[model samples]
Every structure is written in structure tokens, then in C-alpha cells.
Target: MLARMTGALRFSPAEIAGFAILAAVVFLVLPLALDTFRLNLAGKYLTYAFVAVGLVLCWGAGGILSLGQGVFFGLGGYCMAMFLKLEASTPAATRIQSTPGIPDFMDWNQLTALPWWWEPFHSLAFSLVAVVAVPVALAWIIGLAMFRRRVGGVYFAIITQSLAAILTILVIGQQGFTGGVNGITDLRTLLGWDIRTDAAKEILYFVNGALLFACLLLARFILKSKLGRVLVAMRDQEDRVRFSGYDVAQFKMFIFCAGAAFAGVGGAMFTLQVGFMSPTLVGIVPSIEMVIFCAVGGRLSILGAVYGTLLVNWAKTTFSESFPELWLLGLGALFIGVVMAFPNGLAGLYADHVEPRIRALLAWLGVRGAMPAPVAGGAAREMAPARSVAGGRQSGRSLQARGGASPEPGP
Candidate 1:
């Protein structure tokens, strides 16, 4: 803890304050700088960051490439959307509305009154709880069933994809309760504020930026913890960690649930900004997009996920809507280029290009000396240990026991 804190203390006052100033400008002042349309798109990109952060944990650290983050995102959005819709209908105001207390679709499906299941969501309090609780519960149950059986890799990915597909189907099929394929729409308010107002939208965007920052900090804390090392260990060698007496299933389950919760938060924020939610939001395609976001960002790095989501989503919104024809080809080619060139993700490119320059600059300052050569070599040996092709996960266990080494040199 001291080492980490001390390292943080070394940041130049200028660098630290500049970072704060920049963030304040982007998050606080930028909404005022941009129009509602631009702010809305920026908010969407930030929500993707939330999902990408979760992906970084599951795919990069835990070796679980989940394609069902969209399901969680949709769930959260729908949960909150339901409440907002109900609120707009006015149980939240002077008097409650008539029976059914839901959108018209619920009335059309032969429903007479609000279902007991939806009763809690009428209150904003329950909706907020449901946003986090529901996704985490689903993830916990699914992870328990799959991980304990040692199901993983492509199998796990497929299961998650199926989860997204199935959820979309269910939501669409339930025309009354779920608002059918349209899911939910025409939402005009959130927390008693009219989302239609520019001021409300601006506040929502800032809240989202704050949430993204908080999630990033949370990821940093987790990565610096012993559990994080164990997570990385499990990523490299599941069976070895299991045999070593750790409850591997529990660890995996925890991360899976945490990632799901993050998705939920993102989804909720997304619904508030967009004023809509549909089966399409939670479908297989969107889930895959979430995965692609993290992969394109830099699967192994938290900040990479943020940058990748913003840059790619910005391009998607800017180009796809404008060109209509060549945009998809450009997007497809971008995908191919990223995969073919930077397998580790955009952050990998950043590490490759920028990290070295930063390191060189530090060296030139002579305030921070060069990393000791032997120690530098030992750290690389530590992060990726050698094992014969036949060794399997056993190599990671041996590697962990062998050394306490620093990180590999940037790039």
C-alpha cells in the first residue's frame, strides 16, 4: 500500500493538477460546450466504458470472454426505465394513476393491474436496487452452474451469447410486461427531472462521467490487491489454482457478478440518456459489440478500455450516420486492421508507441534512474514464465512462487 501510495505521491504537482483540470473541463465544462446531441452521444460512449471495464476483468484478468454484458445492461436499463415510465404516469406525484399502473402494452396484453413483481419498481428506490441486484443475481447463478463444472473458454463464451439471445427473445415475447420488441420508450423524466430538458441531460452526462471515473478507480484498487494477482493466476492456470485449495469457482463467480453489476450501471445510464430501451439493446449483437469495445480498447488495461470505447463509438456515430454506404466497410476494415495488427488491442498500440517515449523522458530527467537491468529482466520472466508446451497451467504456479519482480519495461 505504501509503495503504491508513494508512487502516486511522485506525480508532479503540475501533472496532477493538469489531470484534474482536464477532467473538470471535459466533464464539467464540455457539456455546456457541446449541444445536447453531442452530449448524448458522449454519454453513450461513457456507458460503453462501464461495460468495457467489466470486460477487462472477465476477459483480460479472469479469462472469461463474456458476450452477455448487453443482457445485464438491458436489464438495468429496463428496470430503471420501467420506474421512470411509471413515475411519468404519476404515482410519484400527487395521486396514483389507474390500475395496471404500467405502459399501454401491459394493458393490451390482457393485464388488469400491476403484477406483484413490478410493484416494487413503481418506486424509484426499488428500481435502483433492481438495476444492480438483478444482473448480479443472474450472473451469480450462471457462473455457479458453469464454473463449478469447469466449463470455460469458447464454451463459456457461447453460453453468454446464448444468454443474450434468449433474453432478447423473452423480452420481445412478453408484449405486456416487457413492452414487447419495443421494450420501453417515450420516457420523459428521470428522478423527477425532465430528461427532455438540456439541463437534465447535462447533469446526466456529468453523473455518468463521475461514475466512469469511480469504476476506473475501483478497477485500479482491485488490480493492486492480492486477489487481483490470484485472479491473474487463475486466468493463466485454473486447475492449478483449484488444486492449491483456493475456491476457484467462488473467485470466478465474484468477478463475473461484479462485471455484471458494472454492465447494469451502464445500461441504466444509457436508458436515461437515450429515453428508450428495446430488445435490440440487450440482444446478441449488442453484447458482441460490448466485447468488441473492450477488445479494441486494450483488453489488459483499464484506461485502454475507456479510450477504445470513446474513439470507436465516436467514429461509429460520426461516420455510420452520415455516409450510410461506405461507413460499414470502413468500420469492418477497422475491425480487421485492429485484429490483424494489434491483437492485444488499441491500448497495446499505446503501450507500444507512447510508453517508450514516456519512459525515455523519465530517464533523461535523471531524477528517476533507469530500471536495473537484471531486475527488469526478472520481471518479464515473472509476468510470463517459461514452461514446456506440455506443462499447461502448472507453469503459472511455478512462476508465481519463483520471484517478486517489477513489471516488464513499457513496450
Candidate 2:
């Protein structure tokens, strides 16, 4: 019974504690600490967390480096934007424009009729579905073609980057249909409810945080599953995994599509929080920045990715506001610092330096005996004596009492 209970717990004690602390921080600490405006900013940062978490699965586990995730983000944001725009463009609301039933930008560009593509977005249901489906479908096609051909590594990254550049150009060049270089703006409401209110912003923050936690749980399950092991196996030893009766291409494609779906949901959330979507976010720079968020957070750790996104964006906002000219230099230095000092990111630093000290501190505080030792895969390990079990027998009772030097084995 004891062994079964121990084996049933998938996470180590430290990991479970870490997650509990994170939940408290997001759901309790931040709200109590910040004003409404500041909390809204945090909500905006959480939107990026969605993208960073997705990258953890695709790049960290599957070893697929896609430089165009912003494309999917933009797709989802645009989908949501279209719905808001249509809602705001009701004939009664647009009576002053030459085209009384269409978007203001279309009227400005001398477009008398709504574009065929824009027509579908008029339905809230279709728009909601498109927010996720469009990006996944695009990723599916791209993954199918590239993975089937065994195209990966730097070549795959370059192709994705090119796609991002092309999509940005197309959105900019198609003025009447895509709102030109300005992208989508002036989004008024969602489903007849004003999203610009302070109360709405506060509520949306919780919603975003809850959704992020849900995604983290889903990603955690995937990472602990057999398929996740297959992904890592393919990452380190693709030929061996392929020859072991596994369909390597299928796993790669599935992960890539899943990542796209995650990014799409994030983009929609960003549109809601920020009240706009733009071509600027769909270009090469934003996509690469998303990668940096994952890298700085420890790409393999989902929670770390969330923190990374928040920290980096918070730094960006702070420095850009106070020292505008120095913001770019500071950001570049951050990227360099993370890569040079802690290649595995903030999570890596915590695991390597901070966690051991924490354990020692807890032990000194007389709480160590109640906690399990750190997991085996971590950098350090501590052994503890076995305790009494059912029927008064010591757990793992062995040669220790029989005068042998060998200690009880650690889990």
C-alpha cells in the first residue's frame, strides 16, 4: 500500500510545492499586491505565457524549432479582432460612414462591399472556432510536408521565419481587406459587452490566469505520458526511435500542431486584453522574442516559461517606460546574460543553486523529515532513513540492521 501510494505521485515533493506556490502567487499574491492597472499589465503578460508554454513542448521536448509561431498568434488575434470589428460595425453604429454596415477601415479604403473572407467572421461562433482551428490547420499542413521530408534543424527554422515575413507582408499589402500596415484597431466590445472597463479588465485577468493554469496542466500530462518520452527519444536519438517501430513523423506533426493551437488561444487572449491586433506582432522580431521567453524560462519547464514571459515583458515595460533609449541595450544584455550564465534559464538556476539551499533551510527549520527527498533526475540528492510502515515493519527494511554497510536505496 505504501509503495503503491508513493508510485502514484507523479511529481516529486519539491515540484508539488513549487506548483502550489505558483498558484498562490497568481491567484492570491499578485491581486493583493497590485493596482487594477498594474494587474491588467500582468494579465497582458500572461497572454505571452501561453506562447512560451507552447514553445516548451514543441522546441524543448519535440526538438522542433519553429521561428514563425507569431504567425499563428497573429491568426488567432485577427480572428477575434474580426468578430469585434463586425460587432462594432453594425449599421446603426456606422450610419455616418459611406458604407453603413462595414468596418471603418474598409470604408476608408473605398471598399463598398465586405470581403468574402471577412463575411465568415461576422458570425461569433465561426470566429471563435477560427481562433484555434485556423492556426492548427496551417501548422498541420506545414508539419506534414516538412516532417515527412525529414526537413528539420536550422533549415526548418529558416523556412518558418520566411513564412512569418511573407505573412506580414501580405497583411500589410492588402489594405482594403487586412486594414493595411495599421492592422486591426479600435475594437469596441465583445458580444455586446464593453471590454474596455476596469471591472472587465480585472475579471479577464483571472480568466487568463485560469486558462494558463489549465494549459500548464494539460502540457504536464503530455510531458509525463509515453508519447512525451517518444518525443524526447526522437530528439536525442531519432534513428533509434524510428527503427523501434515508432512513427516519428506523426509524433512530430502532432506536437507542432498542438503548439500552434496553444499559440492561437494565446493570441485571442492578447487581442481581448490589449484591445487590438497588429502586423507588428506577426513579424520576425516578435516570433524570435517568443523563443527568448522560452529560453530564459527553461524551455523544458512549463511553469518556468510562464515566469520567463512575465519577467521579460515586465522588464521591457519598465525599462522602456523609464529609460527609453536604454531599453534595447538592456534587453540584448538580458538575452546574452541568460545564454552565458544560465543556459538552461531561470528554472535551471533555481534547480542548480537555489533548491539545495532551500532543502537545507527547511531541514534546519525542522520540516525536512516531513518532506520527501528531491527527485533523482535533479542535480543533487539527499538520502533519508526509512520510516516505520504497516504492521510495525520499517519501510524497505534490509541489510542495514544485518550489519551491512550498504544503505537503503533511494527512490
Candidate 3:
């Protein structure tokens, strides 16, 4: 019944068209007007946009509140940074007797030579894969252990937070591989690509913008699919969804891995654009900010995620530059005000002005039969749910009830 009422404002194509064009305009025009410095700033916001989209899926769609994605983001960033740092070095610089051209901390500690473990990162491709695969595999194992036991909500948040804290401590203590407190620096190039060049900066800017759009498209596709509905089911009624027949743990694992992977992409984009990353980027403060971005954006909504990320980061950058001393106060007041009054987010502002006509267009297109099947969500999940185990806590109808048949099952 609640779903029915909300369906009154069913999604629309006209709205989607308008959004696509506006996004293209922003992507196209911004680089023209902005200086390289400002373009880089836009890149940073785009990275944050990726993070916010993941938060939307894990929080908005799945009902699993994660606070430690920053850790995953950093893992990917630091990993990529290591590779870039390696590539930036000359073969002569890496020689054993080579001037002890150690990382600065090593100079302080009298250490020498890049550690053996750091060597594989010399290959650009390897580093890129490590950045993505490492965090996702870790998230997969962690999600399996936790979600299978049905640990979620606050408990899930706590576990993720603990993971972030542990990672930070480990990185700071290792001193050798991680570069200790000062963190990795002096990274100047990537794969013979001169990062200092305006061309490089522009390319990186395009990478950030393109990835944000891709993630947005992916997020919207997932949300519109039947599997997406199942994920939502698992979010809204974990125990019941299980009893009805779905492998709840597997569904959770997939989204968890996906969210971590998205964070990794964001992290890589961040390191490449910003040219630095440290424990601070992955610490508790950032973990909190990730949640705040999701919350202010609208926990379960993609548009909400994009809006919140761009707006929050813009505010942070804008305020910090203009009034560095008042940055903290400004951020705090702004978040507090938004949470208190417009928790649903600026996406709501967009919807109010434009959604009705969009829905009407979708309905009209439906009548013409020229449109392909509505692909609001993207690629389908491969795993099949054990339907006998799926259902109970929710008042909403399951996909089982909707079609009396499953969409062709995934791998």
C-alpha cells in the first residue's frame, strides 16, 4: 500500500532526459571556464561523487550503514600512490648502492632500499588491478562473515569503523612500506604521463567526470532492476527475506563488494588528481564525513548521493578557501541545518520542479511502444536466490509477488 502511494510519483523519462543533458553541459562547459586549479577541484568533487553513490547503495538501498569506506578508499589510493611513486623513480635511483635515496622517513630512521613487497607495483597495470581487487576481495570476505550472521545496522557500522581504525594504526606503525606518519610524497608522474602538464591535468579531470557519470549510470541501473528490488528487500526485511528463499548473505556480499570497489575507484581518482593521500584521508573524521554525505544526500537515492557529494565538497572547498578559520564552523552549521530541515536532500528540490512531466513522458512512451524495456537499473546480479528461503518482515510486495516469476536468474 505504501509502495502504491509512492508509485503515484513514478519515475519518468522526460526528467531523465533533462538530467542527462544538464550533466553533459556541466561536464562540457565547466572545463572551458575553469582554470587548471579549479578543474582539479572539480575532479576532487567528482571523486567524492563516486563515494556518495556507493554510500547510497549500501545505505540508501541495502540498509547497511557503513562508516569505514574511507579505509577502502585509502587502501586503493595508497596502493595506487605506491605504484605511481615507483614508476616515477629512475632505474638508477632504485640501485642498491644508489645514494640511499630512501623515503624521507627512512633518512630519519637510517633505512635504505624500496621494500621488496613494493616492487611489484613497478608495473602500472598491476598497481591498477591491485587498487581495485584488493579492497573488493577484502570486503567480500568481511561481508560474508558479518552478513551471514545477520549482523547489520549499528553493529555493521561499528565493525567497519573498527576496520578503518585498525588499518590506520597498522599503516602508521609499519613505518617501512607505508612511509609512517608523513605518508608517501614526491610522486610526480604516472606511466610516463607527466602529471604536472596541463594536458595531464585536463585528462585527469575528464577521467573524474567520466567515472562519475559511469557510476551514476551504474547506480541507477542497479536500482531499477529486479535484483535491485531484491537488494532492497534484503535491506528492508533481512530475516523475512531469508525465510522466503533468497540467499540473503550472498546478496549482501555482492553489494558490499560493489560499494568497496566504487570507493576504490574514487580513491584512485583522488590520488591521481590530488597527488597525495595519507592516513588522514581514511581516518575516523573522513569515515564520519562519508556517512554525513550519504545522509544529507538521501540515504537510498542516487540523485541524492550526487547532489550531497557535490554540494558538501563544494561548501568545504569554497568555505575553506575564503575563511579557513571558519571552515569547521561553516560545515557544522550547514550540515546541521540541512539534516534538521531537508533530510531528503537537494534531489528533492529537483524532483519538485521537474518529476511530474518526466513521469508523463515515460507513460506516453509506454503507449507508443517504441521504447525498449525500462532499464532503470543496469546489469543483473548473477546469483540465484533460494526462493524457498526468501520473505517475512516487510509489508511491501516482493519481486516474487510482482511477477509470479523471477527475472531470468544471473550467474
Candidate 4:
């Protein structure tokens, strides 16, 4: 049982190395290298990495492509935003407004009082729960409705994309409640502690990094389990898995909800790090872009998703600053190029080309366990030339025994 448990929890050496390197970069290197401002930007980018990691599990491993991850992200962000917004809108602070206790946007729109639904968010604990639960609940509903009916592939993708568009429109239309296109801005505090300070931002960045690592470990655990194998089987052969007595729809629903939960956590972190949550993030374009981040990082690679999110967002910031009008086009072209030239994304390239060379170098340097065990038939192939030489020597001995002239061995 101990052996089985150990096996179940075992991660590959490469994966272990990846986790360590990622931790070092996020926790140690970036904090030391970047200023608070740049670090905060990185924290924002890491928020999106949550969604990308979910996509790696949902789309990469399970073959369930969702383009409405932004919806979950928005829900989580809004949940946290509501809490912060409420905390900021103290009766004393908003005494000049039409509604003394309501949010400023509600006051601007001539709102009379805080809505009933917003009451629960007043509690930090409840708000945090909602941040995860709301998105997961939505995912559960969607998965039950669609997966039960066997809806998937391009159709599912389109449905998710449509949901993103619809949610964006709804948020904009409900301006009085949802803050419209301006989003929930000017967030001030968490538990009465001002969050806008540079020191606060730095703390939040580290917190975000820690949360991200937790998510990474959770994802790693899921992928390493039997459930992960089942997910892969379902991805490649759904009917086979279903026929083998597994409830395919339940598995799909579970993974879909898990992805939504991850997105929700990311969204909440985004709000804390960026000081706002907006309808712009809950739209079709951002949703698709999130998918692109996953794809570019190698949808199958959890760590790669983080790297991809950082790289793409970095490029986006750089390009948008220099060529505001052409950045979108450049992004499209980058995605196209990646899809065409590197279908498996950066992770695939590393695995096929880079990792092998690194392993070879390590092995040459006499590092133990640097090289993987040889594959079946590999040993036989390697020994073929030696076997041929041995056969030649045996033939020479036989000829000498038969009284024939022995062949001279040449150097």
C-alpha cells in the first residue's frame, strides 16, 4: 500500500525539475530582478496563467476545448471585487453620495441601496468562497447540460465562445449592478488594510505566486492520478472509456468544473493584483486569447502554460506600446505561426529537440540517471556490430580447425 501510494504521487524527474525552476523564477528571481511596478504586472500575467493551466487539463488532456474560461475568471474577479468594493464604500467614506453605503458606480447611476445579492460578499470568507464556487457552479451547469447530451469538439468550443460573448453583453447591459464597461474599479482595501500601496502590491504578488504554485501542484496531482489516465483515454477514445463502464459525462463535468475553479481563483487574484475587474476580461476575444496562451505554451504542459502566458503577455505589452494598431494583427500572426510550425507548442519543441540534447550532455558528463532507460530492441540494435565481429572471429576459428588458411586480422 505504501508502494502504491508512492507510485501514485510520483512525478517524473523532469517535472520535479520544472516545478523547482518555476518556483525559483516566480518567487526568488523575479522579485529580486524586477521593481514593484513590473512585478505587479507579472502578477497580473500570472493570473491569466491560471486559466491557461486549466486549459492544459481541459483541452490538452481531456480534449474539452472551452473558450468561455473568461466567464469563470470574470465571476471570480467580480466576487473579490464586490468584497473590496464594499469594504471601500464605507458609510462614512461615501456620505456625500446619493447612497451612503453603496458602491460609487451605483451612486453615479442613482442607485438607492445595495442589492441583496451583494450582501454576502461583505464577508471576506463568503466572498472568497463565491470566487471559487460561483464559477464552478456555472461550469457544473454547462457541463451537465452539454456533456450529458454528448456535445463536444468544435460545437462545444463554439458554445463556450458564445457564452463569453453573451456574458460580456449581459455585464455591460446591467451597468447599474455590474459596473458596465468601466468595471469595478478603484478597489481600495482588503479587511480594512489599504491594498493600493506599493508594499501591499509586492505582498499580493508573492501571494499570487504562492497561489499559482498551489494550483500547479493541484494540476500536477490530478494529471499524475488514475483519473488523469482516464481523462487521456476519454480524450483519445471516449466511446471506449464509456463502454468500459466509466461514466464519461461525469468525468467531463468534473474536469470542466475543476478548470472553472482554477479560472475563478485566477480572476480573484487578478482583482487583488490589478485593483479592478472588467467586462472586457469576460469577452470572446480575451477568452480566445487565453486559449492561445495555453496553445503556445504547449497545452499539454502545465509549467509551459505559465511560461507561455508570461511570454505572450510580455509581447503584447511591448507590441501594444510600440504599435498600438498592429499589435492585434501581430498576435494573430504569432498564433498562426505557432499553430503551423509548432503544433505541440514550445513544450513539444523542448521535448523533441532541447531535452534530448540536454540529457545527452548530462549523460556524457557522467551524471547518474541523466538518461532514460533504453527502449525495447535498442540494446539489440546497439550490439549488432559487436555480434557481427564475434561471428567473423568464430568463422576464422572454424576455418583454422578445418585446415584452411586462417585469415589475418587487420587493424
lDDT of each: 0.76, 0.83, 0.72, 0.86
Candidate 1 lDDT by residue in tens digits, 1-411:
663456432433323333465367557766777798798778888898899999887888788889889999998889988888777655444133344345666766777777788778878888999999999999999999999998898999999999999999999997888899877888887766789777888888888889887887676566546667778898876766867789998999988998999999999999988888889989988888777778787777676677678888888888978997987688678767777877657656654565456566767888464432212211111222232222487666667654423235468
Question: Which consecutive 10 residues in model 1 have the weakest lDDT in total?
Answer: 373-382
Report the C-alpha lDDT of model 4 over 1-411, residue by residue, as the tens digit: 654556647554666677888899999999999999999999999999999999988998889999999999999999999999999999999999977989999998878988899999899999999999999999999999999999999999999999999999999999999899999999999997889999999999999999999998898788767888798778766877877899999999999999999999999999999999999999999999999998898777888888889999999999899999999999899899888887667776666567778777888899977445331111111112222235458656645544532234465
> What would you estimate as the lDDT of candidate 2?
0.83
Ranking by TM-score: 4, 2, 1, 3
Q: Which candidate has the top score in lDDT?
A: 4
The digit string of per-residue lDDT tens for model 2 on 116-221 reads 8899998989998999999999999999999999999899999999999999999999888888899889998988899999998888889888988888888877
What is candidate 3's lDDT per residue for 309-376, written digit by digit as tens?
Answer: 76788888878889999987877786787678655455543443444355468667775532223322
Answer with 2 or 3, whichever has the higher lDDT. Answer: 2
Worst 10 residues of 3 by lDDT: 377-386
Pairs in steric clash, model 4: none
Which pairs clash (backbone N, Cα, C closer than 3 Å) in model 2?
none
TM-score of each: 0.83, 0.88, 0.80, 0.89
In TM-score terms, candidate 2 sits at 0.88
* CA error at residue 216 for candidate 3, angstroms: 2.1
How many Å off is the CA of 21 in candidate 2?
Answer: 1.7
Candidate 4: residue 319 Cα off by (Å): 1.2
